[model samples]
Target: MLQGEEASFFVLCDGKTALPLGTAQDHKRVGEGDTGPNTGGMGAYSPAPVLSEAVQERAMERIVRPTLREMSRRGMPFQGVLYAGLMIENGEPRLIEYNVRFGDPEAQVLMMRLGGQVLDLIQAAAEGRLDEVSVAWADDHALTVVLAARGYPGRVETGVPIRGTEGLPRSSVQMLFHAGTALQDGTLVAAGGRVLNATARGTTLQEARDRAYALVDAIDAPGLFCRRDIGWRALGPVQDAPATSQPT
Candidate 1:
């Protein structure tokens, strides 16, 4: 056993991606480029525009519904949320795995998209009234980027001074949520593998991506690094776009 008592793991099937096309990637490390051993997820985001509603509906029919039925038949009676991690390999959706809980960075993005009534949705799920609850997504697309410690998933140097978080426009559709923050003598300090989630909601995925990167620029931390091309794979060509420019 890998002794994941303090951690959690999920099983992903290769064929799940083929049901109704969607692509997802896991944040396997506390740093960039899949380097180092896995941590509790430095961050994640999803609903790549390539994953159309038709595809997601197919996944619900072919994968999620059937899996739930099978689990119930086997007496498992799974009742919590399911994270179906997936990836597109050679234009085909492949199941990366299944997670029993919400993905970290992914959760932040989803929650931001879910907006004000998140508590209500959870309650409905718990009460088996999911049918009665309908998700009203904002017309805008959203993205979340994570900031982590330098040596995260390992021995990290904490308590570093962080700055440049004030004066953000309140109506700018951007939010900075604290994931691993601690107050030491009334000063906010980094405390975990992933520390802050900078999220933005916009009229489209490209717009959301633009806003997200803008928020990243406002932060002044040398130890922080975020994937500049978060939703690029799904949103389509932004290869040569400048980091500070807003997408149309």
Candidate 2:
């Protein structure tokens, strides 16, 4: 097992050029100890401290650039968000895998931290004009907690009504993104395993985690649960170590 951080980078690639959009850490395990089966993502946080400035540079220089170059050389010319899942082993970033677009919970946190720059950057990349775009990230942290239905990552029980979604604290820092949700005759209910994402931004990782968890607490749903330790490692020492799982 790679006993390291689940660091990921969203790099906007436009054939001839590539630019990093942001970074995040996603929790994929279904259980608190990171034990149990892997799901899409139980929770996630942005600006993972494990992915230090030095590691970010190494990832771009060794992994992202080479991958893009190889893709272009093969005539594929990959464009869009090339999300690199990296494992920082012995202070050296190592490759894990790549996603074609923004990750679920990771996207929630990154978008929270980056604010409106996300859309502009994506549009620029799609138009192949990344050179003209620049990202302005707030020096803050964002966290997201996924509310999942019972038996998630397996045979989930759906159609459970969800409550407390109304009047969420909407502002520049807090928001909710709907995923596995639907309205049945004007009733909001869980449509899939992972139902809703509660995201919040704060000056520190702990504050962000606290805010996200508070949102999760406010939400009332049958068979809904989430990990309390979303960014435990990033905050400080791991009081409860969760098992590692694959990224969505």
TM-score of 2: 0.91
For model 1, how does the per-residue alpha-carbon lDDT over 1-248 read when each residue is reduced to its tens digit? Answer: 22110111121222222122122333555433444577666544545553556545655666676887677678766665667754533333345568766677676666667666767766666666666556565566677777776666567767865678776544447888887778788767787767788888788777777787787788776665555555544554445644332111
What TM-score quantifies how close candidate 1 is to the native fold? Answer: 0.74
lDDT of 2 by residue, 1-248 (tens): 77666688888888878988888888888876577788899989988888888888899899989888888889899888888998887779888888898898898998888877777888888899999878887789999989888888888888889988897898777888899999998989999988899999999888888888778777877567777678866675446432221222
Stretches of candidate 1 exceeding 4 Å from the true structure:
1-46, 89-93, 169-172, 235-248
TM-score against native, each model:
0.74, 0.91
* Model number with the top TM-score: 2
Q: After superposition, how far is residue 195 of candidate 2 from its true place, in Å?
A: 0.2
Q: What are the lDDT scores of the predictions, listed in order?
A: 0.58, 0.82
